[model samples]
Target: MSENLGTMTDFSPDDSVMLKDVLRGLALPQKNIPSLYFYDQRGSELFDAITELPEYYPTRTEIGILERHGAEMAAALGPGVRLIELGSGSALKTELLLGRLEDPAAYVPVEISREHLLAAAARIAADFPDLEVMPVTADFTEPFDLPEPARRRVERNVAFFPGSTIGNFPRGMAADLLAATCREVGAGGAMLIGVDLVKDRATLERAYNDAAGVTAQFNLNLLVRLNRELGADFDVAAFRHQAVWDEDAARIEMRLVSTRAQRVQVAGRPFEFAAGEVLVTEYSHKYTPAVFRSLAEGAGFRVARTWTDPEGLFSVQLLEVPGAAQDSSGGT
Candidate 1:
């Protein structure tokens, strides 16, 4: 096993996988391992840079909308609320919301990275001396309950799920995750969600596949991460980054394509990759307005109001949980 030493700035390609099960799953005849694993410290930093690219409109556009309408959203929801955020990255755009919120009692940031969660929470605590910071490290996709500390706040809860994190989930999983959040916070709570809108293919494609090749490195770095953490032997030059538009599915697929046939041993097991084998990393599903609303309603949320950028490139929707109805018949 060769030890690859370099950062994403030097990211090449490889055929490694995360856990043993993950490697087996990816090597399956037909299966797509998740890309969320790509979000190591370096990968996260690269993503932050990706957001700053001029071609990436979602981050800036969403921030702009928040800056203009954050106070309005706070006022619409009332004051002294507990703000819970899911998948809080750097929380860069969220300062716009945090600064404008109606004197939140506590700010809870949920993240998968322990280092990031603690760092972001510490910064927020120092910045907002008046507000309390509660950081939880857990995967938000599954039906896992919020932490004990999080559940203590029985007051009016307001979730700040910024970034296009919801898009990371497929339609079914998205609805389930939203519903789970609603259930956790209970009725009279609020969920402020950021969603990317469907747009022209060229613009969308450019955002993920940047000219500086940063996005490519970010995608390919997943293998690097696996190799470093797991005992795996993977040739970093055997694969390439692939970003394709799946118009039929209305989503963008980011995959790591095998440049040539290669055999890799990971997690105490050996696996083979065909010359054209692809590891489907991530699928960012775009949403139409009507579709999002229908999803929220289906998940026991009342669409209160939404803020969209001038060009309609992105949206921030505030949903009231079970406003006046919860027993209404819908999907399970």
Candidate 2:
């Protein structure tokens, strides 16, 4: 392993912002919480565990596609390109791409977890001795500054956003995120994103509501996080995890349903919950090929190419600036 030290910054979750969002969301008519809050250090670890579950097909399917075609994706990107990944959790799958890219300028990973970001960056630095590992910790949803080191060494930047995380955003927010990413990488830069394809409702439901109850534990961990961080009094045992496929919304909605009528206090604010009342935890939208392509075009990116497993349960799409060279690799 190389002793190269990668630079890392701490732009973690803002305490005040989190408090405001939590209170505001709890006050809503439907009572919801932003999925972003699900990623404190513990939540991040639980998510990592969720990715490895046998029922969680997105992670494995995306990795399989990349394992088979990461080289082709890098080839389409050409040489001397800076690779920046958004919400780069663990960055485990990225090694496949980094191994194939020819003379890449740098590897900039943008993440929200400071600890996780630093650890992943250090591992990447050791693994790729010659590659510049500049890890940034920031909420990728917002516009943030990149360190001088990144701006100085980057050439043509390629933003890699895998893991079907885009599904977390609704149509409008997803568009805004893509626009922000476009600005980060500049007009002539490119993007490679993983999207979960609209599949059978049973499959989608099973993926979120796993049999081992690990998913349930992961969902409940949010309460544990709130109790510790925000001084919230949540009876973890009083709530149960529920994942349902919303056909009308074309998304999987995860909620923590109150087992009984109860009152909870968070940071001195009291809230009442009725029996069976639920707090909306997450929304993961599935998309068809046409829908995703349209979204990319609207966000100012052209679909350069797409790769998918034989079953088409997921898709890894290479999107580029309009004038960028089209990759003859097409689809697989």
Q: Which window of 10 residues has the lowest lDDT sum in candidate 2?
A: 323-332
lDDT of 2 by residue, 177-223 (tens): 88767656665788999999998999999999999998898888888
| Cα lDDT tens digits for candidate 1, 168-256 | 78889889988887776676777899988888899889988889988898987877887887867778778888887888888898888
Q: What CA RMSD would candidate 1 show?
A: 7.8
Q: Which candidate has the highest TM-score of all?
A: 2
lDDT of each: 0.74, 0.84
TM-score of 2: 0.94
Clashing pairs in 2: none
